[model samples]
Target: MTNSLPTESELQEAWIELQEIHETYLLPYEVKIPHVDQYYETARSIWLAVLFYYKEEQVHKDVISDVCQRDKPGLARDQQVRHLKREGWHLSGKGGYHSLDPFQPSPEWVTERNRRSGRLGAADFTQLKKFYGNACATCGAKEGRPDPRYGQDIVALQHGHMDPAKPANDKDNIIPQCQFCNRAYRSDYVFDDKGRVYAVADVGPVRRASRQVQKKIYEWLMSVFG
Candidate 1:
């Protein structure tokens, strides 16, 4: 059977309802995707689910599921949603994303999912800052100029743990810099304290350059010049 797509008006109205729910709820929710593309797709699906569910109240749940099942991933990847009797993201029998417990905090749901994925805990900021130094590792911006609005540096520095949940707190693992730089640059491969490597985000320069190569080059240069 052919799948049905929502009309423009329906999509817009549903999105508005979803927006209201998001504003009211905004609590952290952890998402899981073992692969890179799957992760992005999951995020998109969540967004679309929110946009449509608010308007039709999930009347189109069957159609949506059918289309997804017929597509590349088929029914296997699709999650079997259940009404969140105790938390948010409850799937009513109607079968669509619904925000029943909008105000209820889903800390248990978030923590449990992240723990399963091995992505728990925030970065150890104190230790992380020492290794990378208090400057934008990329742009080398230090002591940024004051901002008129916040009465602080326009570039407020933060300890950017390469991985937010799985922080290394290592000199190489953490970078001290403003939010802009951290968001832009820190979303790449970085070395943890144990010399292990990890990818932060979906940015270019996927892998980090070898420290061994750098050390050898520096040592050779020192021997030649000094």
Candidate 2:
């Protein structure tokens, strides 16, 4: 009987076909196919090989041999590595490989870190929600309402950091915001002479309101009092 072992090209073709099938049928129907985990593992191995080649700066044959345990022909391996590099796999730094799968701290560690740093806790979240009247500070969208545009439930009020990159997690740096406004604001802000903070228009996602909601509220007050 002739040998039935699959060739490298055959394996690659099969992977492509499986991906197409997943995209066209499985994803749309939300159905899981048999041996799907195997398919995922195979795809991950392919990506890991590419990442290792870039991070290690070794020959494709050496990388693939290490990853796949089989000796691949030189030309095929070279072409594969070249394709990965072209698809944006260039090394950024000595430790750039860590960017592929950054380490995530466990939930317990996160809670302990937050506690040590005085980050908002469950009680603080409840108090903040009450202080904001359970509505978005910018949009006045109430909690539990369905967002008109997306049909998703309005995002629970989030505590936005005045400086997201180096958040202080203090009352002075935190404000209640809707999901839309929080995402749009993203880390861009400016402080006025009086120490009031405002979102920076040029650097952040485009302003969500046509006019300042806070300004409109003040204008209404001035009109009523006068």
Backbone collisions counted per model? 4, 0
Q: Each candidate's TM vs. the true structure?
A: 0.27, 0.31
What is candidate 2's TM-score against the reference? 0.31
Highest lDDT scorer: 2
Candidate 1: which stretches are off by over 4 Å?
1-3, 7-20, 28-40, 43-51, 54-61, 70-72, 75-79, 83-87, 94-226
Residue-by-residue lDDT tens digits, candidate 1, 95-204: 35433334333566655554543222334554333333444544445536553433665666676565645555643445556666556664564534322345444434
Q: Please give, for residues 1-226, the per-residue lDDT of candidate 2 as tens digits.
A: 1133334455555455544544564344232223443322443435433343243343333344344434232323322323332222332323222212111222343445445443234357666666566777666678778778658765677876655545557665665777877776556664321223554534333345445765775588699997
Q: Which whole-number lDDT from 0 to 100 does residue 129 have in model 2?
A: 65
State how far residue 220 of model 2 sits from its true place (Å): 32
- Residue 62 displacement (Å), model 1: 2.7
* Candidate 1: C-alpha lDDT: 0.46
Clashing pairs in 1: 82-91, 83-91, 84-90, 131-171
> What's the C-alpha lDDT at position 133 in model 1?
46
**Stretches of candidate 2 exceeding 4 Å from the true structure:** 1-123, 163-166, 190-226
